[model samples]
Target: MSDEPLSIDSTSNEYLINADELSTVQYINSTSQDKVLVDIGFYTATKKDLECLLNSEMFLNDSVMNAYIRILKAQPSINEREDGYAYLETTYNANMICGDTITSLRNKEEGNFRLYRTSTYLNNDMVFFPINIKDCHWYLVVINGRKGVVQVLDSKGTATRRPQLHQLVIH
Candidate 1:
């Protein structure tokens, strides 16, 4: 509801790098793609991935988005908030839900790989899915689990995938 920034790291930049992390960011920027800049949980950011954050024109990459989600999930304030919020990784929404049709997403075969089930999130008042659509755009799919409402917050107002996204969220 608020545009207020989350101080997950320290920097106000989308890259979310603090003064301490500037050196690491610089190293990653200077090095080749093979270099591992930051490893936050399952997501890894390399030189190529860091570019997405450093360069605002570039679309936000899955690794960067997921890494930030992981960081947000780890924040004490987010976890302690009255409105319990849960976060699903970019992989979950992009690959598992959005990538497949509602029919396939409903299939029980992929249940074992569901990250949401294994994640350490509190009760889902608001479930956030930071999605990378077709690797060209990034938007948020916020599910109000308590209120049974699904909201799409896309800056560009791309409604092409709304129907599919709704089906995926429900099923």
Candidate 2:
């Protein structure tokens, strides 16, 4: 992938400003003269042009789309409680090596309420009765030895659930 930023022509459309030229002109005007006169042409992109630009090879690709999807999925669902409390939870990998808990919390007006992992069992044989609250939702994430955010549930009701396991061959 090219590291260079995308460029758009701003000559024909009056609403568009050439950022590079504007910056250069602004710098020169600021340093040289008390009053600066400038005539700049602006460019406007139509909806069809914008769509075509977005779908172009420079913009549309696996890496770009994947990044967009990741950003979109990263947004968490917000829930409001009747007791003037709001809850937010997002799944994170439980790092067995680091012994870190996959936890989440809400930034409340009073204070933050955090939920952390108490313990973890390998191979999905252990039964977990972490907590049960009607007002709060549960977020479960599965991870490997390498800590990474994998599949996650947005929200789960107050019910007992089991962990899922997948076998993989590591070279």
Candidate 3:
């Protein structure tokens, strides 16, 4: 948050320094509603570190999103960052079967939701469906074709998901 000389802790083993990605950012706070970032100092970080530091709003290019893709692809078990979820959805929309199918669906009455239907439904051994609801959100719906059970996974507990569950289907 400081605009002065930048500093980095040399003791942290989780972070590795890469001089190329180390750079400063500056901007003008034209709005009175929210406190804006006027400047940020430089600090050395690896590609992964830079990706972690960058937020959804700072996802200004493919490099940042690609970094996240590498992380998700490298390890699917990890809970994606909220910003990572944005990029995850983007890549998922482009490459995943659910992206090509009907992701936005309506109830029997008159409503719209994210409980999507995918081509992989009941066709593949494993399927992952992503859903985000208002107020609270679930990350993915894991359907185990072999087990014949559909499970919904979420890092954050849902308050409104119970109602949406009925409209959701694994196949």
Candidate 4:
């Protein structure tokens, strides 16, 4: 796709921002009920405009994911746990390599929690991330550092094209 700048809160930036590293952050939702936000704020589309997409079903390209992420950032009660903490998709992951130079990213609106791949990302309280194949489905995996083990949690049920979602985690 296009390597256009990342935009969140109506502001665009040159590169991606790591949501995991951010200590404090804010979010903004598009209140225009009739229009749908496109990838990285490409264009505001009307529901009728996206009718042919998503198997000819009218859909919000990636805005629903954006809203879910906003909830994760705006309300800790959604993901933060008293017993264990978790991470979500980050803005930096927006450009994650998919097949060749292409990225699986569809939204640059806000809040992708994919942590930086470094020892710093693996805190004493956390664990892992790796690739694995299971039942003909390859998982975008993580090694839970805190638990000292590798694991995969497919949030969207089917471990297919859209398997690597960051909405829910079941420990």
Best by lDDT: 1
Q: What are the per-residue Cα lDDT tens digits for candidate 3 across 64-91?
A: 3344445564564543433222123332
Q: What is the TM-score of each predicted model, taking all chains together?
A: 0.68, 0.20, 0.36, 0.37
Indicate the TM-score of model 3.
0.36
Regions of model 2 farther than 4 Å from truth = 1-7, 12-59, 78-171
- Tell me the TM-score of model 4: 0.37
- Least accurate 10 contiguous residues by lDDT in model 1: 1-10
Which residue pairs show backbone clashes in model 3? none
- Which of 1 and 4 is the better model by TM-score? 1
Counting clashing residue pairs in each candidate, in order, gives 0, 3, 0, 17
38 Cα displacement, candidate 2 (Å): 36
Those runs of model 1 whose alpha carbons end farther than 4 Å from true positions after fitting are 1-25, 101-108, 111-122, 158-164
Q: What is candidate 3's CA lDDT for residue 122?
A: 31
Q: What do the candidate models score in CA lDDT, each in turn?
A: 0.62, 0.29, 0.39, 0.37
